[model samples]
Target: MKPLSPDVFDAAQALWLQIRMFAKGMLLPWRLNQLLAIAALFLIAHFAAKPIGHWLTTWLRKRQGWTKWKLRLGILIQQRVRVILFALLAWILVAVMRELTWPSRSQLIALAASIATAWAAIGFVTRIIRTRLLRRLVRWFAWIFATLYFLDFLTVAENLLDSLALSFGEFRLSALTVIKAVVVTVVMIVAARLFSRFVTRKLAKNSDIAPEVQILISKVLQGVLITLAILIGVKAAGFDLTGFTVFTGALGVGLGFGLQKVISNLMSGFIILMDKSIKPGDVISIGDTFGWIEELGARYTSVVTRDGREYLVPNEDLVTGQVVNWSHTNDFVRLDLFFGASYRDDPHEVTKIAINASLSVKRVLAQRTPVCWITGFGERSVEYILRFWISDPTAGITNVKGQVYMAIWDAFKKNGVELPYPQMEVRMLRANRDEENAPHFQMTTSLKD
Candidate 1:
């Protein structure tokens, strides 16, 4: 074999020396003992986790007086009970071991405990996250960071990421900065949304507050919280606020041009809420869409029609266009209907029957009562107008009208009130004198009601 080059020989010798040093360190009595301790602890944790988790779940189930959300949280804990138990066990054992011996002797156990604790926390949080992809990303990110931290390489990684950066004027952007911004922004925004929902629900339950007022207050609170969240997130991400002044100015200009309708809709939402003209469950008619208000969004209003179709109408349209609010100030609605009877029927008796028929409908308001009057006498029938009041418009207008009409038909049939149909007559005459003298018999024909 040819003689080795000096560079290769030196590299091999250095590698061997490093290997020897590593072997020597591992051979240390304390190091070997700690390795054995860690292996034993792993076995203990693996076997003990199941029974302890079971016991915990059983105990939690047996408890009384827990709120629904509390019970839900308990269920989440129980699902991660294995990791929790392991974390507790490792911490307790490692603490006792550290006290009895040198703390450094139990470094492996301490590392394991830290990792277990982090994993348990991540497990619970990831489970609560609704998105599957997000949950997986968070889990992996947390595990990598925790492992890096325990291995003492987190600072090195951070420094490496920080080095990969771009500079513009006085501003610098890096992988670390981007990651921090995203994480901080997501966390703060999620917290804001959760808090907004909780507070909104509380406001909704307050009986003294009007529904529109509740909606307005909740929306205002949400807007404030989200704004604060964005600002705080940017601050936490280590950006220079002074440098962002130009960026914000440019952003405002972009929004003004690109989002004119969007901004209008948002502002319109606030106006709608403030004016108290419409609220949740109010029957409204906008152009072709007719329904009760289901919810008020920043950009749109949810209207659920009687046909079960939900239309998301833009808030700007609601502000600008005509909206017929049936239940604006009161539940009473006066509906006018036309009916006719034969001229033979007494107008007074027919009026009483029609009024009773309208009142007999379940939705017709008894306190307000129904009124009927003869409008005019047609050529063959008496034309009358029927008017009635309904307190619950949201129940539906068309259906109630049909019901009242049916009730009227039934009452008319029972009371012998005749509903007349059109009658027509045709007479043919011959100009001849002979035809005029020959007719003792004349034919008459008419349509019956």
Candidate 2:
């Protein structure tokens, strides 16, 4: 309300001039015309893209030769057809504008078109990447670079990224350097995995190569390739490896203390693979855990029990501890069942019946047959031992044993063979002098009564 100060008046006048200049720039004939053209192009594209995309997609689906390729292409069209059509139209419009020699607007329109095309391309690529985190990272990187390029500041941004660095002695690390290292490492790792799988398949197809040998080769190649990739990435990042000699020495000492069990397990895994002591599908028993080996990993062996439980056993345990490998040489296993019959029953008949019972079970090996013999003469019964062979201990030993026992019960019941129990006969004795004095003491007691 009062008279404004001199400084305030000057500042207000400057602000008013800036507002007028901004309005004037917006009102320029060429700028306004370019904006209108962009609007018009966007509207046309928006309306035309859907119908065109639908028609193209339908046409592609009709011409289906390469079944696998066509299926993949059909998916792409179904999801991104509109974006693809719009991008194409924008590019065509940009080209036409350039041909007309509209220098001021052509570059801007081309940049916009390029951005739309790049976005569509990135979207398609990210869909193929599969991993959510990796796809998001790629999307962010693509959009950032695209924006920088559109703004004509790509070189400046790169320079700034490179300039922001930290130096460690002769080694310098910058944002650009780190980015390059990460990209190179990721690419190398992916390539190594693919190559390893290809080599593994080839090795697996070779009839001469054992499965264990194939596994060993694949694992070794994978380790070497990954290590090589890391080294190459570090070198590309401009890191001087010679400077890390002391660091590595210290790291080794630290690892020795902290990762003794891990290193032992890793070495033990190599020993197991080399010796072929424990392999996949091999039935093994260690301590109380008995199961077939599902997988032999670097640190642990996956063992799945009959109860549908999987245990991750340390590799070192298999190397150092006593492990009973049922299928080490062959799947054949011998099981013994002990029973005794009443002394009154015919031992010969018992033995024959036991043999038939053992043969009755399906899992019992018929070629080897079964044997029954007298093991011991017990106090109450004659102990007989029934021995049978089974080819698949992995299927289970206890269940087969139980089945054979049930068969024995059925055979014994049908044959009228009696299973025996313990019986004791007790007798009491008196001293000789007590026996002699008994008649004299009995006469004296009768007179006293």
Candidate 3:
């Protein structure tokens, strides 16, 4: 026998040759029989899986008085019943082949059956994983592992992966190490997200916790958990964290310059939450954007306007720019409207009519009663201010104000109170000259009869 080359590929090839030679040494007739038996088993399992799965699903669904656990089990069976049935059949065939004395052929048949069983099981398990990307990833790795195991080349594959190394500064990483780190990190991140959702739901159910506090706590926990997950994954991958101190310093510098606004928004969000200045459901107006707070996030606040437009306002602007919180402290908001009536109408009577008109609006809060006051006396009309209160600002401030104005119009027209408009008066005069050098005064007029 010739010695095999020292290269990894050469060694793998040599191992494959040895296995093939051993298999060829088995009895030709018995090997053919085993092959035929394995083929028949596969065909039987394939043909039978669907009908058996359908029957099991129907039975499970038809059962009465099913508990939550039983219902979940039934759903699981319904989803993967075919795969489960096929796996069972393969495992049984593998057991039957194992009891045979055909040595090489029996081992080969059993290995194939075992691989089929493992594939089915992997499919079943991966189906339960919710994330589409993660499920696909898991399936790929599972098949790769099964393939290596069946070929008896798992150790050789591991060695090959480890031999492909890259050096960075004082540290070195192999393909295997990088893959482990990525896989572990992804798994931990997904787990953290799931746990965060669970905790968020639990916290939200507690009525005692303020909404801002709940949001803050949830965000903080998520950040800490994800950070921990990354660090743990890196450590598990056998990398030295100390080597990245300089890199981290550089990253901080980059963040300071490039992410200044991002950091400012994050801090501003925390400040808003801590101060309870702005929160979800608060009707606010910033610059031209007038809307209710739909959500408060780390970087931005979602403001949904009455026109059905949603604007993402950066948290920094909310903190620095002028903001009108209509529902702050309480939902009751007082609105002031100014109108003028002709000076002919009595001021007292106009005030009374205005108050009554404001009161006619359904949104006007009765407990805080609307009041009308003489704000000023204008040249053409008597100016008055109507102060009214509304309990729901989010229903809209402008809409209610318009309603009040409309009610006032109806009231004024019915009561014969006329609205004033600008008017101009012209006067004519004649003067006589008293002195000899005085200029003559003249009036020009044209008349038609």
Candidate 3 local lDDT, 1-449, one digit each (tens): 84423454655565667567757854577667766776776677667767877887788878899887777766766666555555566567667656764455476566666776677677766665688988889888988899678867677677667766666766777888998898788778878978998999999999999999999998889989999999999888898888889998999999899999999999999999999999998999999889999999989999999999999999999999999998888888899999988877888888888898888899999889888988887766778899999998888888999999999999999999999765444445444665465444455542211
In the range 6-89, model 2's lDDT, one tens digit per residue, is 544554555556557756865777767765766777787778767777887777768757588667767676667666666677
Candidate 1 stretches greater than 4 Å from native: 1-65, 92-106, 123-143, 190-209, 287-290, 304-311, 340-348, 373-383, 420-447
Best by TM-score: 1
State how far residue 380 of model 3 sits from its true place (Å). 6.3
Q: Per-residue CA lDDT of candidate 1, range 1-449, in tens?
A: 75534544554555556557756876788878876876777777778768877887888888899888888788877777767777787788888988899898887778778988988888877665666887788788888988777766676567656655777877888878988987887778778978988999998789999888888888899899989998899899998888879889999999899999999999999999988877888899999888999999889999999999999999999899999999999988888888898777889999999999998888898888789998998866898999999888888888988998898899999999999886766676555685666535345767545
As for TM-score, the candidate ahead, 2 or 3, is 3
Overlapping backbone residue pairs in candidate 1 total 0
Q: What is the C-alpha RMSD of each candidate to the true structure, in Å?
A: 8.3, 11.5, 8.4
The per-model lDDT (C-alpha) reads: 0.83, 0.80, 0.81
Q: Residue 84 in model 2: shift from native, Å? A: 5.2
Full candidate order by TM-score, most accurate first: 1, 3, 2
Model 3 global lDDT (CA atoms, 0 to 1): 0.81
